[model samples]
Target: LLWSSGDESRGAEQALFQTVAPFQTQVSEIERSRRMRGKRQNLA
Candidate 1:
């Protein structure tokens, strides 16, 4: 019973990670791109 509960918790953790990880990565990339564009604009 304990083992089954642990497996369920693990699955939920993995699902949460899967949902949020991509958004985190996408947000980081967007911020980086915005910074690069700002720098280029400053140079020009």
Candidate 2:
């Protein structure tokens, strides 16, 4: 019973991770672009 419960929790964790991973990548991409724009403005 304990092992089954552990597996259930792990499955839930994996599902959460899969969902959040894309959002994290998108946020990082946005931040990268923002930094590049800032640098360009500074240069100008």
Candidate 3:
């Protein structure tokens, strides 16, 4: 019974991660672009 509950929680965690992963990647991509732009401005 405890084992089953643990598995259920794990599955939920994975599902949450799957949903959030894309948004996280998008945020990271935007951050990377912003950093690159800053570097370009600094170089100029």
Candidate 4:
């Protein structure tokens, strides 16, 4: 029973990570672009 419950929780964690991973990548991409824009403004 304990092992089964542990497996279930682990599965849930993986599912949550899968759902969140894309959003995290998108957020990082946006931040990178924003930083690049800021650098361009500073240069100008």
Looking at model 1, residue 4 earns an lDDT score of 100
| TM-score rank order | 4, 2, 3, 1
lDDT of 2 by residue, 1-44 (tens): 99999999999999999999999999999999999999999999
List the lowest-lDDT window of 10 residues for candidate 2: 1-10
Off by over 4 Å in 4: none
Distance (Å) between predicted and true CA of 9, model 3?
0.4
TM-score of each candidate structure, all chains considered together:
0.83, 0.96, 0.86, 0.96
Off by over 4 Å in 2: none
Pairs in clash, predicted candidate 2:
none
Task: Assess each prediction's global lDDT (C-alpha) against the native.
Answer: 1.00, 1.00, 1.00, 1.00
Q: CA shift at 28, candidate 2, in angstroms?
A: 0.6
Instruction: Go through the candidates in order and give the clash count of each.
Output: 0, 0, 0, 0
Candidate 4 RMSD computed on C-alpha atoms after optimal superposition onto the true structure: 0.4
**Which 10-residue span in candidate 1 carries the lowest summed lDDT?**
1-10
How far is 12's C-alpha from truth in model 3 (Å)? Answer: 0.1
Q: The CA-based lDDT of model 3 is what?
A: 1.00
Shift of residue 9 alpha carbon in model 4, Å: 0.1
